[model samples]
Target: MRREQPSTQEAADDRTDALRTEATSSIVGYRLRRAQLSVFQRFLTVFESLALRPVEYTVLVLIADNPGRKQTEIAEVLGVKRANFVPLVHGLEQRGLVERVPSDFDKRANALHLTQEGEAFLAHARQVHEDMEQELVARLGGEKARKTLIELLDRLT
Candidate 1:
């Protein structure tokens, strides 16, 4: 008797399982990259409609939480190049989601802050991100697994 061929989805699922069982899964760099890809895919699904990229979301959150922080300071914490950071901030400024003002302590450094519009947008964005995070937590098994994974990752960082 001849066996039926697997469907495309079945083949893909098999391939995915094979990837998880591969030696690369044991490597921190490889595993982290694969995990980042999965998380970013879900992030896109949640934030694409709002036209928010991950870096932008991080910047928004940072500025909202640390109002008056210098652009350079935020860039440093996020490990973004100054050249790249400028355009990111510019895009947010153009969208009226952020503003820069001269720092009171430093004449040269510009302090970052979320505009009223940004504050409102961030509220919705954060809710979407929370939903995405819950989805990730469920997929990773449960809250315990999520907490353990986060703790492990934090140790590395």
Candidate 2:
């Protein structure tokens, strides 16, 4: 008697299972990248309703915390190149979530500030973020493990 052929998805799954990742898995950078991708995937799903990306949420938080900071300074802190950072800021400004004002310290610079709408949106976003953090902490085996992992990761940076 002849056996039935496996379905395409089953064949693909078999191939995937047969692949070896041990070499890359042992690398710190590879593991960190894999972790980041997993976290970001969850982040995207959680923030989908708010129409926010991880970087955008990060930028908003920075502006809220450091109101009146120079755009260049904030961008530098986040390691975002000026060219790419400009369009990100412009999009936020166009959405009326952020505003740019002339800097008092540097006539050539623009200070960044979040609008009232931004403040409101960020307040809600913060709660959502906190929830996500709690879930991650639990998955990491609780707060102590989470803290340890963060400390180890910080050392790399």
For each candidate in turn, the TM-score is 0.84, 0.88
lDDT of 2 by residue, 106-153 (tens): 989999999999899899999999999999999999999998998998
Worst 10 residues of 2 by lDDT: 11-20
User: Candidate 1 — which pairs collide?
Assistant: none
Candidate 1 residue lDDT tens string, 1-157:
9999999999887784433566766889988998899889889888989999999999999999999999999999999999999999999999999999999999899999999999999999999999998988999999999999989989997
TM-score winner = 2
How displaced is residue 64 in candidate 2, in Å? 0.7
- Candidate 2 Cα misplacement greater than 4 A, ranges: 1-17
Model 1, TM vs. native: 0.84
Candidate 1: lDDT of 138? 92
RMSD of each: 6.0, 4.3
Q: Considering every candidate listed, which one attains the maximal lDDT?
A: 2
